[model samples]
Target: MSAELRDRFFALSTGGAPADEVARYLAEVDAVDTEPAATLDGLGISWHPTVRFKAVRFVDAERIDADVRELFARPSQEAPYLAAVFVDPRELSFRTFENIVPLDRLLADTPLDLDLTRRAELAEGAYSFSLRLPAAARGHLERLDALNLYVPPLNSGSRGGERFIFHSAQLAEALTKAVAKALPQPLRDGFSHVNPVFRCNRFEPGDANFHRHRDTPYYDAERHHVSRYTLLLYLTGGSATPALDLTGGVALAEIEPFTCVIFDQRYEHEGAPYDDGRKVFLRTELIFTFTESEVTHDPEIGALFGKACYWTGESVFAPELARHADAYYNQVAAAHWSALTPGADREPFVHKQFRGVHFVANGYDFWFAKSDKLSLAECAAITLLDYFNCKLGDTSFRALCQSEVIEADEADAAAWIPGFLQDKRGDSAVPPIDKSLLFPEPEEANNECCPFHSWAAFDATRSEDVIELYTQAQTFAKAHILPAPIVMLGEDVLLDPDKFVIRGNSIHVLGKESLTPVNFAACWNAGGLPGNYIDIAATVDTAHFLVPPIFFTESDDCYHLRFDFFRNSWMVKHQQVTIPVPMVQDGVCDDGDPYPWRYAVDEVSLFTDNASDRGKADLWWVDNPAVEDEMRDVFD
Candidate 1:
């Protein structure tokens, strides 16, 4: 009987059973089971013994249906949607029940600054302050890696009083595991992780109350995850009123401390103003990713191709390219062409073999000879015609060539006809082609080579050949194509000479300059004095200094230069060794003055000794001679 109950409990816990059903079943298990706590713990339920699960169904059917339809329309597979679930706290019937850890104990060592001056002001009269804490505070929770605490900048309609937001990976993981235990098998399988960032709202009596508003879905690009539901963990209790007042006369009034309310983000809800006492609650999001198997079943080739193209220019491309490359290639190669779809316009194709050829036209235009110019597109089309003819060995190629879409220019068509006809007829007497006639060297002014030029020369017969061509194209691009020049600013100021007059004491930035990783590394290893710039010198008024090479790291949002002097030895000894990039924020340095005017610095100006020195004029020894002697004594 006990074994049967265990199986049923496990089935209900993981099988996406309704919360009410699971809750009722837990009661039954508790009544009959000898070790109910052990059984529940073994199944991954981490809630306190006093907590009882309850489903809070909203009355707004229209809104719920709309949300469901929207989720269904998403390209990725959808997870189960629960309108709301109320985790009610009940008096413990059993003896020696384990109690939840006190919130004060959990936040004992955490430093709190209640100053609202520096905090970001929100809608209504609400304001907040935040702090970042290590995950170690919540001991035993392995998934909580880091915590970021801040008050959320709520949307216009929503308003709340002073709230401290806690974004903790540990809390997210703990909640995720607990939630997963109650989810159906399909949803459990699709569950990725809970959003680490959760809002901790503290609304005192007479504080700004939240107005009715729908939550916008939170998207995490880094995780490729989205929040479908909002989880509210009520931290403080004693109020008779429900914390959340929803649309359509429904109210979630379970004001018991530790009672969690999980609801869909689509629900229009508001925190009703309470004058009786304070209300504190933790609000977090349940995040999930689309299953790979589902996404792969009917992949969106166009979107994937677009993403792949964007990734090509990004610093981090390898992982992203690898993800979509195979799937995109497979879809495109297997696609059959009958007619051109709407929005079929001339654009560069992602694939190398199809470069220059109209990607849209390739879908419906069966004919090889369409355009008049003997350009790269024409060459590629002709090559494709020959490849298909050779591979299939039939009249199909000829039939396609004579299709209704064929709009050949008689003069241009005649140029490649002889060689094409010779190949088709298996004729050996085809003369050695004058390569210059077909592909003349472009003028020096227009000599910018396409990264995929090499691939155009080689005919791709199979997917492997296409892959090899892509590899070659990447190699060519890395070798020949220089990325857009990184603009290194001297300080926070713009360095356009036309916009800002070049002053006598200011550093004059020339045009943009590109720095390869090799150049940057060499400069850093050689202690800011690269071999190429040994003879170069820059002068500011009467002072002269060797131009320091600038280095920076790139992220998804912005670029940053490390300002740590210990990492760069030259910076320690020379006051002039500094890359004056824009400061991320306005701040007063130790000297009790605002930062200097930021300006752009050109690499050539620095290397050619044209850039002015704007650093401190006094020597380090003059300011701190005793420190120099102490450093020498320590070293000696």
Candidate 2:
């Protein structure tokens, strides 16, 4: 009610007034009280008369949850915070919201302790009170305005939440002490003083006022550190409605000069908008974290650490790695620059642009049994190949042709595969494959079938000797080089054998429904070593697969398999004949850009101009689509 209207009511009821007039005044007062409070334009009072008494009434219930009752009984206990109430139950009260600190008192040089005590009294008595900020803190904000030291809101582009922000050590210390006094001793002990920031949020016409927000939970994975509590203090603002409202509970509309609100950080609340009016307020947060050393010692947490870091002790020394990584990143960034192509859209396959060697060591599995000398190079080749296939979908090898080189060294390799991968500086000097080789013209010749196909010369039924499947497969592969699907029937039907056998087998190709006998030379098993080590076959399915090759020489390890692309090792060997891995697109043949060789071939020419550097004749292939038909004819 306005003061003018209240004065008229009192005047009429006082001294010698008619009984009817006094009764009318009382009736009007009752009516106004029962009706909703009047609000100014663009401003409102959110009141929930029931919220303040909720805690008390809940506790008073006979059938209240035991855990909730216990939590209300002692809210300051450490760990396992109660979920029913976000704030400390002790701070909640059922009382009228009023400003304990007036603007005049805040302008005065009042001691912070006296103000803090006054604020606490209001809290204990009325349940909600807005006390004045410490005189020194208020003066500090004035000094900031005078010196023009405030910076624009850091997150202005998003929610222009702050007008300006300035840091003050003196203000932080005083506020921290004031907040510490409110919290119970148990909570105070766990609190670590983080540097506080003083920010003035402005609510003006068309400005984005504060929205509902919660502080981010501070987490430290290594130490298992996490935030426990928070404190927020509201200093000053212009609008009458620009006050803190713990929605459904308390609203400190008429705040005194240094009015502060302290609550648990997890509380869901928002700053009331000033509407068309302008308002400025200072806010500081006191963040606390719990450092429970026991988390590190717990068996499950310890196991997680081992699993997360891949059992490498290197994770323990982060500072050492950070120092080197930072310097190295800077050096690499300085050496490379990207060309800007305006209006050009990025390729779908372009993961991202990097200045230099961008390394990402995601999750990895490093459990492998060591055999023989335990060749590190072989491990690198195997790991990279596995990563290429599993993570990048095997097409990454083709995608690498356009991507910036990412140099990965042993130090940068994932912790799981430590000391296994190292940067081979000379590998960069090797030329990349020519693009023309990938997109050969129609005149290019495809791989021809072996002229003297001699696999039929061998009589399998007559031979009862046991021999290595790998050796026999290699012989058959070299002899019968056809694009059609070739099947080598081993001693067992499924190809699972610990020892070799002379069992008769059968072979079949697509369209030929009946299985042909193995003695008819219908089978060719040159597909390295199958997992079963039994019936090995390399069918013309057009699907690319990588199999562990049995190396004859120690020198033919991972490095040779990966980087020594000049040689035709069994791991990256291209087949002699070509076949269409039929891909039906809209029920028609979709040859898929006719360059499986870009992925299948080990070496690619990096020469931009086709005529400048003719590649080795032996290494090049003329991809002919007609060969697929010829192979199909042979199969049929």
Candidate 3:
């Protein structure tokens, strides 16, 4: 009797019969055989021999509690039972049928223009589209108690599909009741909801083939719920050529239409290729949430899990960094709390906190130091607290946490104040200090180059000076220095400065004018600020600075500013009068070397072929005319 029913069902499914006809035949098979697994075996539907199987007809949600209990009663090494088939397609109503069938038709009719150049980059020949189900369809699925079986809408696209997420209270209750018994002791009572999102796939038989892969767990946008299991439902089935192949040599041939397979996402599986027919499936996930106690095993420690807040620049860091910071803080907090427990695992906690400190320190050093938006002292304090908490042993850490006072010498701030300022002034040529060195690491006690000891010694003798220098250094680093200005004569012609010399009041800039642009053309000069002169001098002498303006006649465009060597003034446009050199000069240093002077030019006018456009041949100015007054004041 089972063999006859199976043959009739297969013929109806593969012979282009309506889905309702195949569904009606399966309902008839369900009427004769009460056992789902026995019916499947009798009908020749194969599954993994080692995998445990249980089936619940979609219409019989009331009986799920008893069935789930019976399935989990047997001893199983796997945390969750392998697979559960939601059988009997009779529950797929006409409304659900209308929502699904038209999507396949739309996908077929839509014209897809595949980029031939990117053929290798495409995912096989199957195209994917992100779509949402119609409001009416969602309402009908809810009314039919078929929310779990809802299919998303289909549209035309090139590759990769989008996830559709929707909430259904009825589906959540059914899933919770079904998997409640199988959850671990801690997670049994914490059942949250079935993942509302559906991962839909449409595979055309000669074009679509999925390689052997394991699905990763899904986390919701907020990360409050995570999926441990994958729910796969086949809406249409044809062609036995491509079987559902599992890791254990189990190949399910001709999986009946509307058969929903629930399995662990960790299971490795693939779809074999077929020469004919198409397969469409919708994949959803079962999501669960863990409370603070369940996650950290302690209520007090769990309180800190999601509470730590860190500052991050939206433009500077990746968007995911904020989420990662929350997770890392929770992990580190849990480890720290666990270490404080009596007779708890100490080494692992210490190691975790140590690594976490480095992460926090590096993040601040590389990113936050440049912006100076986050407080470095606060970051250092947080890291120091973690270090002391983990390495100081349970008793001492506990005492410190309870606010017990520890004796320590207080250094006099006045002692190192003068010397620190003098050292900073003397060492103005030193390179920029790495801000991360301010973070102390006591673990590397034996390493001579470790910054912890150096920092500690500085703290004792010159802490105030270090703080002052750090503030100034951070400010200095944030200043924006402009690049050398470009002088363009018409579109393609460029005035490239080869050499610049200042004598008295006139500044002479000598360079070649090229019709074709040169790779490097800017006139660079040795420049530095008083505070950072030493550091700047250590590398290249040239610094980015503004050039002074040069006024020239159309007939004498080649004549540039001439610097008077004796009078320290500038002669402009061959004028006999000398303009006092506009330069800010610092007095001679202790070593007798004069500090670099700074000046700027407002505009450098040149006669160009198209200078007549502005109605003046000699009035053509450089790119930036806004600084003309400032440049003129240098000579004034």
lDDT of 2 by residue, 1-636 (tens): 433333543355234888887676556544542211211110111111121111111112112233333323211112112111211111211111111111222223434442354444223212323544546655644443332222232223334444444444545566567556655465576566544445555554456646544443344443344444434444444444545555444555655444555654444345754553545566545555545553222222222221222112121112232223322222222221222112212110111111111122221222222333333332333333222221111112212222221223333233322223222111211112221221212222223222123233432222212122223333322223222222112210111111111122211111112111111111112221111122222222121222222221112212211121111111122211211111111111123322222122111111112323443442122222232223234345
TM-scores of the models, in the order given:
0.30, 0.30, 0.24
Predictions in order: lDDT: 0.31, 0.30, 0.30
Q: Across residues 1-636, which tens digit of lDDT does each residue of candidate 1 receive?
A: 544443454355334788888788667745641211211111111112222322111111222223233221111111122111112111111110122211232334533321112232222212222222234432312111121112223121236664543334545655676666544354455567677666666676776667555454454433556566666666556453555765553575545444555555555567854456767677777777854443232223333332222222210212333323333323332221112122212222121112222211122111122223222222322322222221111111222232212223323433432333222221111112221121122212223232245334322222233233223222322221212111111111111122112233222212223221111100111111111111101111100111222223322322222112111111112111112211111112233112121111222112222123433323221122332232334335
Q: Could you tell me how far off, in angstroms, the CA of residue 424 lies in candidate 1 after the best superposition?
A: 63
Which one is best on lDDT?
A: 1
Runs of candidate 1 exceeding 4 Å displacement: 1-158, 184-189, 220-224, 240-242, 291-636
Worst lDDT window (10 residues) for model 1? 536-545
Alpha-carbon shift of residue 377 in model 3 (angstroms): 11
lDDT of 3 by residue, 215-252 (tens): 54544423456565566656555555445665653456
- 1 versus 3: better lDDT goes to: 1
Worst 10 residues of 3 by lDDT: 571-580
